[model samples]
Target: MATALKTVQSSEAEEIAELVALSRAAQEQIAHYSQAQVDALIRAMVWAVAKPGVAEMIAQQTVDETQLGNYDGKYLKIFRKTRATLMDIIDDKSVGVIEEDPVRNIVKIAKPVGVIGALSPSTNPEATPVIKAISAVKGRNSIIVAPHPRAKLTNKLICDLMRAAIVKMGAPADIVLSIDIPSVEKTNELMRQCDRVLATGGSAMVTAAYSSGTPALGVGVGNAVITVDETADLDDAAEKIRLSKTLDLAASCSSDNAVILVDAIYDEMLAKLVGKGGLVLDDDQKAKLQGAIWVDGHINAKVVAQTPKFIGDYAGFAVPEGTQFFIVHETGAGPDHPFSGEKMTVTMAVYRAKDLDHAIDLTNRIQAYQGQGHSCGIYSRSDANIMKLAEATRTSRVMVNQPQSASNSGNLWNGMRQTFSLGCGSWGGNGTNNNITWRDLINETWVSKPLAVAKTLPSDEVLFGDVIAKLG
Candidate 1:
């Protein structure tokens, strides 16, 4: 991180062309590598980023350079995300003939896409790069990163560590590269030239990735909401909410944006949440907050990724001394009330539900207003309630009594795959409803073989036997 991101980076075309050429050359060396060699390459990358000193330095530098997210969280995030991603793909085969069925005489082969164009956001500069790099290498593909302008230095530092590991292992140093200077034009070109794209950013970046005339896996925004029912453990629920809403100042898209509590437990839940570092705001305070964070119908950028104290001060007030986040009682949902949408900070909108039916209905209305097909959460001991909530919501995932941010995208406790990007699945304008892992980076070649004898198809009369009897 010693060198400035754009000090003498030269022209945009030259930089993109240079990185693309180097990555293509590197892919040639990797495309023919065996599964063992690919695994060794990933091991080298995991080793490079998982070191204590290395993780600490990058985390500190990223926070210093971008002034976003917390140092401690970023440091831990590097290890957790990078190690989990590597573990997920460790034993998988990505080379030729990855699958075979002798009885069926069919085979499935894995082929590298050659090169991937990755777009990472400032919210998770270090972790995103590491995850994408590990994913690309697993499929024997090279990656070139286009980082956010605010986080370019951090991205370069991570890329430098990866390049060092590749070179030491006698692979092409260009297997993983980063743009020295980032801009819209350069990023668009990178998307157009690369064989595939993996985009993890805002709506604009995701839209651009899909429009680049290249195969791309782009993600959308997240406005996760958690529901606390009457039978839930208030203390445990409050603690989980606090942990997620305060993680790196709520930088992750999976961070809780709102909470809906059953009418039976509204008051008790609020009181317990206060003991867990939540500060409830009155209508007057909430009005002031509405003005402070919303500008031109959008959440102001100044309040994003900031602490509760900083946000309170910016809004011309003082938060309680131990306040970790703010909870405002909300009665409305739509464009007029910006709180109903994603805030990207340590603030949450709280709503009271008359019953389970009302809670599910309101949850859908909120999702329809913004952040559909992302995720939702529930905290209830009853199996019927959990299943009912899941069946009612249109979200991609329903986290039960788990921290929305930590476990939504694959965690140690949950079976979800580890990833930095969460696909919104059409509802949020994404193609897939997944955690966006290495599985999305490769193409499979299916080979068909002749069977010893062809089986006869069932007649329409046989297929319709049950229907015909019912009709008669």
Candidate 2:
């Protein structure tokens, strides 16, 4: 996430303290808003950015402002993610009684989680802030954004627009505040001071949020290893992979950084990928690729999330014109084979597998090296192949015939809840496997009445009677 933008606002302590207090006060007032009021507020805020030319303008500013990612993809990202997130919450009851069980005479009430500390990623600067703000407001909670220092202006623009919506709806503008300046110390203080933190950022920031001595939701890393089974349509699989890696120059952490292709279709799949604007690099070119992105056993931030052509040029070679991404043939796994790890750029490691079992094993090894519990994907017509990958791979979600970048977070085409923040399961050091949404933002209270008859378990002797008789 390194960039040339070095201007950081001073007074880190004063900025964070003021924002935190303002957000807390705003949440206290919003706590009393009715369910309808909360819903209206959320809807107004979502559409505020979705208006004509608004998203396109924000998308342009995001790329121009941060000097990271592409404008076209960011444009679509901000538009679709905002609309989808709001759609995901439109029907939900979050203010008062939300769930009830008549048989158990129980009621579940949803309450706001108070003030929220949000850390936005520079990769998807505009979209992350917008989606997180929507979720926070939907739960009747006020949010204070701690944006990536490189993209502070874009994040401020996002918050200012949403705050306008809040005030237009007769709510406090402080309901959605952002530190005018962003810094590490300020973000840390926001997490420490707020009621809860919603962290969507790099691994270090996430770890800090988790260790902030406050309740938080933090995400983990990704080096998605997708498998292309023999039964899969090579053309379709190639297209989907291309779509994911090319989106925002592969900004989404869920992008497929590695692919394990069954030997039966390996050659044909590579050809198909080449046909779809992918350049399969020779060994020498692969070395150049490695040198450009890996520096002293670490991923070089300079090449991360860069265009395929820019990456290839940076590596000292010219990628074919119109090349959407590049694939490097990899022979090993783990740290020794850096290609198997998350490249973050629009480059992937291609592995050949002997059969179905071998493919699953390869996927596991690659994921273990980096993206353990984030996600893996499989493209096949056979249910057995899909299920096999699901059971064998240590991934939080397994996408089937779906583009990883588009489907991993959430999309209208799949059942995955629409979200901007995807939680990597325990394997990825996150609390929940479900995509972060409005559900994660609210607190639940349970009220129950006694049952008509007392409930108790059978005695051990009665449960063991049949077994004892048989044994005797």
Candidate 3:
């Protein structure tokens, strides 16, 4: 048995190695592609899946295969998000000679990072792979995707579609590849062999990516918390929260897992939320929900990304006919309270704060225990309060009076770069704080020329006068 297991492991490693080599060969073939050629290939890949019938089919197939998220959400993400990503990088230069600095007499050239190993999560598999493919090819690189087991077939379908598009565009089909049969060992091997790893999944996978000894860009776990102050439009805030929490049944990491209500408007805001298809659970129901949402200290897989009715029934609680989400009252945060963490379902916890300061404290406390450095949002007409929350909380993005899920990952309403991966910086144990995009898939070389005219350097008095005065 031991020998057989060893043989199986060796075979898997060999298979991954072959995929890596194929990807490397394909990447080299495109090393000479001009900016226009690369852009055309990107357009081809985007149109292949973003077209009318194709997007719907992929969305339906993703829901059927993964048994998570809704078809409508998946479809919009597949079609609109893909095109939106294209729009985001439409005029951006990722090829040779991408930038020039006249003052510094420097020319910056972009080069491909070779093959990338991308680990996509099942929750957003349909769109994540498409986005990653576009980003990789934008830099004239190849990518091999290792998807979650539940979304392997969906991943393969998306990869194959993109590969065909590339082939039709006169590019190598091997530029986009997938591990049709994904395993822990196979994914590990791929990460180890690839030039860089783009890991976008759970904590374990991201941790593994960082540990693979290869350069990697991984995202942090998300437990997005939103704060609503007395100055906020209660009705509008409630409506946006309803839309975000119920969208795709809370499949997105940016979905509001917990909401903090200011004491001045806590009652009114809770009432408003209740009016918007939110069912505030009683103590009994809250107890039942805690048990249902978690099993043995882990989120219950069955409840994840499920409809409110399904989660209610599973938890043995009464869900009203039009109920779109469930709200449980909680006062504390930490491992002892499971609701303070990420609940990937149509359920959220509601907290009451004395004021904006308390709200920020609660937000920091909760995130520190679980989602530190991911993201948080606020619904406040008071700019002071909004800025206060933004400065106080150790989070990446702060959505102001907008839907957290729709706004955090680059929505049309915001200026954020469209992306499937959100970096959490050192706070979340990731490298960058920017939305991971094509800009991250390439390396740059700076060519410097002798300056025709030299500029005077700053004197110590000018540079350090303020610091020196403070010291004195």
TM-score for all predictions?
Answer: 0.95, 0.95, 0.97
lDDT of 3 by residue, 300-389 (tens): 888899988888888897798999899999889998888999999988899999989999999999999888888899999999999999
Give the per-residue lDDT of model 1 (tens digit) for 20-129: 99999999998989988889999998789778788888889988988887887788688777887788889887878888887777899998898999999989998899
Among the numbered candidates, top lDDT falls to 3
Clashes in predicted model 3: 0
Name the candidate, 1 or 2, with the larger lDDT value. 1
For candidate 2, the per-residue lDDT at 306 reads 86
Candidate 3, residue 387: the lDDT equals: 90
Point out the worst 10-residue segment of candidate 3 by lDDT: 309-318
Residue-level lDDT for 68 in candidate 2: 79
Write model 2 residue lDDT over 280-382, tens digit each, in one string: 8998998899999999988788888888878887889987788888889997889889999988788988999999899888888887888889999999999
Question: What is the full ranking by lDDT, best candidate first?
Answer: 3, 1, 2
- Candidate 1 has which clashing residue pairs, if any? none
Q: Kindly give the stretch of ten consecutive residues in candidate 1 with the minimal lDDT sum.
A: 1-10
**After superposition, which runs of candidate 3 have C-alpha atoms over 4 Å from their true positions?**
455-460, 466-472
